[model samples]
Each structure stands twice: as C-alpha cells, then as structure tokens.
Target: MRKIIFLSLILIGLGVLLSFRPDRKPLSFPSSRVLPASKKDLQYKTHSVKQSVVHTLLIPASSRFLVTPTLSPELSSLESFVQKHQAIAAINGGFFDPENRKSTSYVMLQGVWVADPKDNKRLMNNLKLRPYLKKILNRTEFRRYRCGQTVRYDITLHSEPSPTGCQLLDALGGGPRVLPELTSVQEGFVDFAKGKVIRDPLGSSQPNARSAIGITSDGSLLVVMVAQKPEAPSNSGLSLPALADFMKTQGVEKAMNLDGGSSSCFYYKGKTVYGKINQQGNQVRRELFSVLVIR
Candidate 1:
C-alpha cells in the first residue's frame, strides 16, 4: 500500500511539472559551415553601380531569426519597429498598401495570421498581366514561406499556383512567413536544382534600389540591399537579372526580392544599415507593417 501511494504521488508531481512548462521551446540553430568565398566576396561596394551604394549582410546559419509584424494595424518605420520589438537587425518585408496600411501579400507573425490572401490578389494580377512573367509565372510561382519551430527554421519557396495562406500557416506549425514573391532562381545553375532561376522578362538595363533575401549554398541567410542617391538616374540600380546574378555570385542557391524602391530599409545592431534615397534626398526609412528581424 505504501508503494502504491508513493507511485501516485510521483505521478502527480510529474504532471504538475509538465503543466508549468513554457509553451514555446528554445531555439536550436544548425551547425556552421565555412563559406566558399572570402568575406570580400560578400562585402558591399560603394559606387558599384555608379552613384548607388550596395550594402550586404551575411547572417550566419546558426543565428536565430524571426519575421516580426506590426502590432498595430498602422504601419511603423524601421526605427519604431526595431525599438518596439527590441530587435538586433531588421529589413522591410513584403509589399503593403499605403492608403489602407494593409499588407499587399500574405503574412503570418508569431503564429498569428496578420494579412489574408485577398490583399495579395492585386500583385498576382499585375504579374499575370506582364507578358514576360506569363511563361515564368505559369511555370514557376514566386513565394517565400519561412517557418520556425524551437528546434529548426525552414524556408520554402513555392512557384505559381502556390498553396493558400491557411495551408501554408498550417504547414508552418504556427510560425511566421513573409511572402514577397516566389523563388527568384528558376534554372541553369549547376549547384542549384533545376527550375530555380526564372528567366528575367525585364531586361537587365534598368536599375533601382532593391532589397532581397537569399539562402547561400552553405545555408547562411543574406539580407542584401542597394542604395541609390535621390538625384541618381532612374536606371542607376541593379536590374532583376543583375540582382539574381549578384546573388548567385554570393553563393545564394535560392533568393527572393522583397519590396524595394522607397520601401527599402535595413537596420542592424540598433543602427540604420542601408536603404534607398527618398524624395527628400535622405535615406528612405519608410514605415512598414512586416519586417524580418533578428533578436
């Protein structure tokens, strides 16, 4: 009888301990691998594209990351967003509507659905209208879905006819995903799988300030941006083709362009890292509703 009573007490104690455990598990990062190239290969160059300055950051594969969304319905500047979340680094996320302050793409923050698929229909329609995008769009959909659990971080790239936001959310297991566009890589790379790099319908002549996220072959995450002087020519930034080429050189196996133009912004270690020039001839730090951050 004594043994039976002791066993019951032990089981009750175990239950109490389990009930008190935290809901979220601690994060575990992947092992680091040596980069194929030197740091100089990843370094940003000023005047690399005539008056524009390109800035790049290589995040180690083992770093903890998150896609933070604005708590309020209104948009927030990079500074405000970083300060509010106490983030170590950040960059503007997917497109958003300026008037209604609604996200232009699907977004999930901390397991909560912040924007719906309807908001992104306009972008999809615009792509459908583009002649060059027709073939690629039909063959490949451009979508970035990043999901994280306490033990691992998974980033999935989907082509056209991608899954619904709810389906993606369910797959994420209640993680965050900031869908800007689909995979930039469609085909023709030895290291990358086939159907990765989509042929650029828009020629490589035009350039503008741009922001992109890429995953290197070694699995490191890269947040790359090009900053241009307000007075620079309209074609002063790297075109889509050039951007893709650059990412490939930096060892990116998969990549996606985030919002650019005046919406480009990057912050690191409590400081504004890089961005495009605004109409006021100042570095653009436009308010954003979604941001990929490191805490």
Candidate 2:
C-alpha cells in the first residue's frame, strides 16, 4: 500500500513538472535543419508562422546565380527550369500576363534584354495603365554585376545604373522592393492618400502566397516562398508587410517581392513546393516566364 501511494505521488509530481515546461514552438527562427546538407553549399529551410510556411534557400557567395527566361515561347514550370539547368536550387521569377503570353517584367541575361516589357503590346497600349507606365517600367529587380573576378548581387530599381567598370551579368525584374523599405506606392503596387488605400493592384495588405529574394548582410542570396497553411484560421499566407518583417528578422538587408500569388514556388534537390493552395485544398501550379537558379 505504501509503494502504490509513493508511485502515485511521483506521477503527480511529473505531471506538474511537465505542465510548467516552456514550449519552444513559438520561436521566430526555424527550429530545425540549421546546418548545410552533406556535400551541398546551400541550405534549404522551412519556417512556419501563424498562417504560412516560408521556404528559404540560402546560397553563399561562392555559388553562382543565373536569372534567365525560358527558351520556349510559352512560360515554363519551375521544375523544368531546374531540370534544364541541373540547378542546385531554383525559384520562380518575374511577372507576366497569361492572356498575351508576354512578360510584364524585364529580364536581362548576359547583359542583353531577354524579356522586355516594352515589347508587350497589351501593357504599352493600355490606356488605363498609361499613367503608371513609367513607374511600372522602372520597378525593382535582382541584378548581378561583374568586375574582373568579383561578382556581386543587388536589389535595386530597374533604372538604377550598374556600377562603373562592372558588367551587368544578369537581372530578373520583380518588384516593389520590400526591404530598405517597402516601395508599394513608388512601384505602383498601391495608391494611398490620407492614410487610406485608394488602389492596390497586388492586394498589398492582404495575406497571400508570396515570393521574395534578398541579400543578407553577409552577402548570401536568400530566396523565399511563403506558402498557405490550410489548417489555420487564416490560411491565405503572409502579407507583403509580414513578409518584409519576416525577411528582416532573418537578417535580409535588401529584398524585393517577386511574382507571387499563384506564381510562387521553389525547387530544390528534386523536390518542388507550391505556394498557393485553393479553397478546395489543391495546389495552384503556375508556369513562370523566368526563374533564378543557383548552381
């Protein structure tokens, strides 16, 4: 009888101890897989927040990045780009119009304009978009500059000139720079006055699947894709501001939002993850006009 009573008391004590134990689930940083994979120079991580899962690929400076458009006239899937390049990792890039099958975002490869929005008839000829044309044309982009053996990555407006003596190796247009401050109004993603939003083309304030790229303080390239979490009360994904905040928390210094919504995706090590999921819980796969790949 004494042994049974002692065991019961011990079990009660353990229950009390377990109840007071601190929960580690709410940490902002990813709690798992911090180290690089075997024989790989890049690190792929998945961080979960309230209503979204952010997929991140961190690539060191030694690895090369290539931003290019699909060779075929039609847009290509993220998997196709990865397979074609035999890339270490890849993320969808730029923006495009499906109706006309023309790129709305600029794409420069090998210092030449591979995909130019100026050539998009619908965009240039639209009377409604005439007022915002200039800003849209000069949206932020991811660029690479090379001087001698030194190569650098940057997130800047399309109009920003490359550093003198440095060749513009590649560039992939996306937009409204998120870090160093969000450029929603300047980039034409939003129109606001008196603290009230008058127009928002990209639904800047709403939660939705988003893709963004940035350069960490250490100069590492960070590609991120925010996916919807269906089980959560709000499974829409992260808003532009939320994404910017998350990136800043992750040590991203300069960042730019990519073509998100249904277009957001990431591919690495023979696996692909889509960002947007429909109300019926189906993944929305979009063919992209361009992609940024690491090799």
| 113-149: candidate 1 lDDT, tens digit per residue | 5665355455446654344333322221122344343
lDDT of each: 0.56, 0.84
lDDT of 2 at 284: 89
Worst 10 residues of 2 by lDDT: 64-73
| Model 2 score (lDDT) | 0.84
TM-score of each: 0.59, 0.83
The 10-residue segment with the lowest total lDDT in model 1:
170-179
Across residues 8-84, which tens digit of lDDT does each residue of candidate 2 receive? 99999998887777882433676458754543267788998658889998787665454333433487888888888
